[model samples]
Target chain A: MDSVTALGLVAAVLTTGSFLPQAIKTWKTKSTKDVSIVMYLLLCTGIILWTAYGFLIGSIPVIAANVVSFIFTFAILALKIKYK
Target chain B: MDSVTALGLVAAVLTTGSFLPQAIKTWKTKSTKDVSIVMYLLLCTGIILWTAYGFLIGSIPVIAANVVSFIFTFAILALKIKYK
Candidate 1:
């Protein structure tokens, strides 16, 4: 891949991976008090749209990043609901 | 704008706007206990890189979204540090 794509890939990895710790924390602590339900709700909606946008644009990095982000954010959202 | 770009703009708005509630919650509650610093740290770093990627790719939506996201994520990060 070109450098720009590489940069995007790296950015994608960092952004998507960032959610892991949040998910893990919520899971381990079983505390969703500080986590905003609205944020995740909006986030999941946004991620779905982003995925759609990615497919429409044929951008692999965007699609891949949002897909993984959806998994992580969705888990956090589920935990928020379950624990809330 | 084209439909795909319009979709991206909407996605950008949603994702960027999602952080407001979290930042507000953290600010009002002054509780970072449930919030993961690592996540925000990673998110901030990732967002910065995403901004760079946006500039490189010349995507207005990506650039605008990531810029606003960086502000919110950075604010959250600051709050996390302050409260922790």
Candidate 2:
């Protein structure tokens, strides 16, 4: 793959992967007190929009990153609402 | 601006703005105990690359989002290193 695509992939992996630990923590701890619900809500909204935008533009990188991010972030957001 | 640009702007605003609270928390508390340092390091690296990728593609949305994200994430990272 090209460097651009590689960088996009890297961005997706690291950024998306960054959430894994937190998600696991929330799951294991079952505590969402410290997490900002507003932030997650807005973030999930933006991720969904970006996903649609990516689809409109037919950009795989954008689509791929936001898909994982969408799921992960949504789970976090849902938990925040449920727990907090 | 076009809808594409507007959506991109919205993406940048919501997504990047989401970091403000976290950065402030780390700044005020001077604590990085809850944060994942390795993730931040990798994320910052990816953000920087995405910035470059945006510049290469002449995509303002990518560039703007990443610039703000880079600064925010990096500041958090620096604090993480200093504190943790």
Candidate 3:
């Protein structure tokens, strides 16, 4: 792929992967006291829209990043609700 | 602008705006025990790359979203570090 696309892919991977730590932490600790549920709620909704936007724009990086992000964020949100 | 762009803008707003709540919560609570420091570190780094990617792609939505996201995430990271 082109360098720009490569850059976007890298960015996508980093941003998408960033959520994993939070999800794992919450899972391991089972503590959501300091975690903001509102943030995850809006984040999940936003990610779904971001996925739709990616599809609309035909951007593979955007679509891939957001789909994975949704999974991670959804898990965190579920944990937040369960532990809240 | 076009509908797809509009949708992307909306998606950008939601995702970027989502961080505000977390930042505010951290600031108010001054508690980072439940928050994952690694997550914010990764997120801030990823956001910087995402902003660069946005510039490379010439996407206004991406640029705007990441810029705002960076601010919020960075603030949270700072707070996390300070409280931790």
Candidate 4:
């Protein structure tokens, strides 16, 4: 793969990795009072916009990553709202 | 902004938003048993790669989004791992 593509993919990995700890912690604790609702809300907004940009450009990589990301985020969001 | 830039921004927004529900849900419930640790791990890999690509290319949009995304995803992942 080209360097640009590879880098883009790497960025995705890092961002997602950073959040895993929180996800795991929440699962075991059944409590996310410390987590920030605004952060999620803002982050989701940014992600969605990027996903749409990918579609507009007909970019497969963007589409694929965003699709999975949306699902992952959605699951956590639901739990947060429901449990809160 | 140019169309490509605008479009890219939009894509970011959509993908992120899709996951907000899940994030929010997990935050409130403090339970992410249903969420997949594997998925987060893989996603983090992709996001980090993408973010790197943007840096290499000097693309502000990619860098900004991935940076935020990584933090967001990392938070959830941490919670999941810790609590589960």
Cα error, residue A53 of model 4, in Å, equals 1.1
User: What does the lDDT read for residue A65 in candidate 3?
Assistant: 86
DockQ, prediction 2: 0.50
Question: CA lDDT of B6 in candidate 1?
Answer: 86
Report the lDDT tens digits of candidate 2 across residue range A1-84: 888777677777888777777677677777865466766777888888888778877888778888988887788788878887
Supply DockQ values for each candidate: 0.88, 0.50, 0.84, 0.28
Tens-digit per-residue lDDT, B31-59, candidate 3: 98989888888888888888888898888
Tens digits of per-residue lDDT, candidate 2, B1-84, equal 779767867876888888777788778888665465665777788788888888888988778888999888898889888887
> What TM-score do all the candidates reach, one by one?
0.96, 0.84, 0.96, 0.58
Q: Report the lDDT tens digits of candidate 3 across residue range A11-68.
A: 7788899999999999999999999999999999989998998898898777888999
Please give, for residues B1-84, the per-residue lDDT of candidate 4 as tens digits.
Answer: 898886666666654544555566677788866566775676667667777677789988667866776676676777779777
DockQ, computed on Cα atoms, for candidate 1: 0.88
* For candidate 1, the TM-score of chain A alone relative to the native chain A: 0.94
Q: Provide the interface RMSD of candidate 4 in angstroms, 1 decimal place.
A: 6.9
| Model 2 lDDT at residue A71 | 84
Instruction: Name the top lDDT candidate.
Output: 1
lDDT of 1 by residue, A1-84 (tens): 799988888888988999999999999999989999999999999999999998999988779889999999999999999999
**Model 1 RMSD in angstroms:** 0.9
Candidate 1 ranges beyond 4 A from true positions: none
Compared with the true structure, what per-residue lDDT tens digits does model 4 show for residues A1-84?
Answer: 986666666665555454565566566666755455555565566667767777888988767766666665655665667666
Better of 3 and 4 by DockQ: 3
> Residue A46 in candidate 4 has what lDDT?
62
